[model samples]
Target: MNKTICSVPAKIMRNVVLLLTLLFLTGCWDRQELTEMGIVTGIALDMNKETGEYILTSQFLRPASQSTVAPTPNEPFILISATGKTIPELMQKTNRNVDRNGFYPHNKVIIMSEEVAKSGVLHLFENFQREQNIRSYAWLAVAKGTSARSLLEKHKTSISSIPASFLNNLFMDANADAVSSNLLNFYKKALKKGESPVIAVLSIDEGVEMTPQTTKLSGGAVFDGDRLAGFLNERETMAYNWVKTKIRNETLGSYDFLSEDGSIVALALIDKNAKINPNVSKGSLDSFSIEVNLLTELSEHQPMKEFNENADIIHYLDNIEKQAEKKMKADIRHLTETAQKELESDILGFGDRLYKRYPSVWNKVKDNWRAHFKDLEIEVEVNVKIKNSGLIKGTLLPESM
Candidate 1:
């Protein structure tokens, strides 16, 4: 018995040591060395309409000189482009221009030109989706009125060394009017039955004199089954964003209200609560009612009148709120009509909402939701409340004036 117990301990020790030796001898066969990799910061896909070929542009991080201990920021990137029939072919061509292997984990954004977007984007993204190295969180945008390569080459970056990073950061800004979407989120919505993807629109703003050319994110590109269907202007984009999301720190826009002379009020949205209710009766859809309640703070106003009395200030503020509500309602109405009548696309998630609430109803119209969407009746209600008028109760004009 004693001998058997001793052998068991010895066998356990031998197994443990053998496992340790195997682990120590193992090598990382798939490990990638930094020196052999070229970090890709951005990618732009454009198409030659006449030639029927794709032009892929890749922005790579230019390595800092090894001689400098701490190198200052310089031209931090270089653009390499290639043309081919397929994305894989373009990538292979791009690889010949650089010494190191292309690495995509650090990639910030992927931009597609209007032409490419209009044609279709699913085939282009297939390679990216299959490649395990490419990140799904990379942002996607559509360049409007310019080629994707031109925007990548020209757009000036102030905060980030990589222009792609700069473009990605633009979506985080609360004041941005465009809709924000990443690769994974885009794919999810693109493949969804009732919903569609809305990608942010990037454009170069030409500067006339003292101003330099800058990048602007003002509108959104609407998609229907991977093909670009239409676009939403800045105002319509803002309204759509407000309807889809809860607003915090977003400025809805300036409103003009007549309160004892012409007064222009700029309201900053503090909080928003939005609800989309689909009306259904006897297994048939009726209409969708969108109710939006907003709490805002007065940011600026052209002081056309003085409000010294409490009653006068109260009356003036009430009128401002009413006018603001009216304007917001009209904006929402216009946006809905544009989506239904002009675009014939369901950029809004009305069908998705209906699906989640009443799956049976969605099942009946799933195949022909597009036709239903174009004729769908949507009602919008907006309520605005100005919580505060900043430090001063009335106009900042001096009493002497």
Candidate 2:
């Protein structure tokens, strides 16, 4: 009787184990196949100022017939648009009409038109923030002088079949003409810290007859708490990059000097360092001082004067360095002044820096930081070092020769 009872228990335990094993053998119930999803490479958001409705445009990647990776002359994307009161609503409506589910993990860019950027953008970001499929590192841009959807539709490429890839490649250069930022950092700056954010500007270049239109990335859209305040030209954008220490080696810089016979010197940035110091007096924020140092290689010297001696070469470079410093300082000053006087936006993060060093003072002014920023005095100092001139120290053909 004891052996029979033990056998019954063992059989029950075996059956339970077998049932658990069968549960583990089941396949994923919600797995989506590659063919069942449409890969979105780019998204453009715009607002109808009159109706206040949101217009969402998405670029879906269409794989090449033969080779998916090879560059093709034909455009490999289709533009789909939807309209609704909110971004999420528009996204849902778009999905209802599309054959394949919209997959957004591979998205490379999001462009907001001027209308939407100027009115406000916080609502649009909330949808993107809540969506887990969208990548946080995808670049953000503001469409300039055109609708976001039109820019997306007009964007043509020869480098790669996907225009989004071309757009991503445009921002990869160290000498990028505009500020580069992503959704995560940008949203954090605006929402978390209550700081201003700047996004790169995208514009379409209508090609000449028989030529294809191309896209251009230049300048930046400066925002004051998620609303477009103003714009930063290419020079100002470079200055902004310098202050933020975003500049990298091999980046190009050029400036013109009237004293040097109206000559223009081109330079390649070799290295850079920046120091932003905030002045606080008696628990009160007073001013800020920014010092930037740059080591640069002389890429082009417009003055064709040859240096006959070492002393002459040294003098030439020293004068050029001073002019470079002056040019850079002017650009930086212009950007700061615009931020304070015109835009009333702190794109340079002066207030944020102050908060880090003296939280007490920042707390007092955080509510009205823009007012303080408008009046706050900032001193800009730039020191440029020309380490070497490429190939030749001076011009090959001299006037005397």
Candidate 3:
């Protein structure tokens, strides 16, 4: 019994010694300090037309003390551009201008110039996916009528001391409103065989002295396979958002309840869901049916009026439904037409749907999926339900009435 107790104590001492040794040996293997790294806020990619080389632009956040403060102090974001045959080469060139190592873990946005996007982006995007430091959930976008370097130069506004934090917050606000796609969503779309990738487009318009810098979320850029085929405007993007079940809270245009001239009543969407059903016919793809349900509440009313179950009120609701439906359908049609006729790419995951529905048949048609998508038909249906009308029963009725 004494021997047994002595052996147990020896085992405990051995275990404790082993744990202490491990603790002592285990130091930060991959730890980096902010001072040792250049925090990349944004990246821009463009193809040089003259040399047929790739231009990679990166916005590195400079410490406040390093920036010029007087004579119209430029923002803390520094724009560096380098040209190379590949992205890695360009990145090496970017590192030459910076004191610290360029790190992308804090990268908020990746802006692909229209030229690079149109030339083909799969290779560049693939590199991003493979990188260990880059975040998979960073926001991706395309710039309009501007080089990636130019876009980075225009990001002079910083809401906080940390420019990277401010830029990230801006994208978060846009994502919540369904105006942009986050990195994870972009990756899924890019990897899906049947669906073409879509990215948010950022358009910057330089302003005069008084006018503030105009940063507009232009639309969605539709990619066919690995190349950009077309773009959607803001309205069309809204429709695309509806199709993707991305919208959180948005005002679905206004309706006149009592009178056409009365204050327009608008419904704010609280929740939404979208589903796509693909139907096959005669061994060929027939059509895709998209069903969208929106739960909304009355957010704003023009003239306060008492709640009534009158015919006019019912008619107003019907009209609102029709108008919203029409707009939504038009948006879907625009995307479909752009994907089929213009881009000749199946930006909508119709190919994946086909594969899931009929795998054996999909194998036969996968090679010519774009051709099949062109011949496909698409239908959209929107169902919106109004739940509550805020604090007021209705808009305030005119005293004269």
Per-model TM-score on C-alpha atoms: 0.91, 0.91, 0.79
The Cα local distance difference test for each model comes to: 0.82, 0.80, 0.71
- Candidate 3: C-alpha RMSD after superposition: 5.4
Question: Candidate 3 lDDT, tens digit per residue, 1-401?
Answer: 99998999899999999998998787698888877988888887888889989888788876764556543355566777888988778888999988877998778888788888888776776677777566877887888877666656644554465434555565666642235666677667777678877777777667889877755565688877567778877666666666664544354333223334445666666677888887777775668888888777766656545756566566665665666566556667886787678877775677887788888768888887767778887887878777764543354656577
The best candidate in terms of TM-score = 2
lDDT of 1 by residue, 293-352 (tens): 988887777764666777887787788888888888998999899988888777778889
Give RMSD (Å) of candidate 2 vs. truth. Answer: 2.8
For residues 1-401, could you state the per-residue lDDT of candidate 2 as single tens digits?
Answer: 99998999899999999999999899999788998998898999988788989898998876663255785666668888998988778878888767787888899989999888888888777877787678899999999988888766635464665677777877665253577788887887888453588888988878899988778788888998888888988878888888884654356444434545686677777678898889988988778999999888887766556656888878878888888898889889998998889888888889888888888888999988767888988999999998877545456775486
Q: What is the lDDT of residue 17 in candidate 2?
A: 99
Q: Kindly indicate the candidate among 1 and 3 with the higher TM-score.
A: 1
TM-score of 3: 0.79
Count of backbone collisions in candidate 3 = 8
Error of 2 at 99 (Å): 1.6
Sort by lDDT, top down from the best:
1, 2, 3
Screening candidate 2 with a backbone cut-off below 3 angstroms (N, C-alpha, C), the clashing residue pairs are none
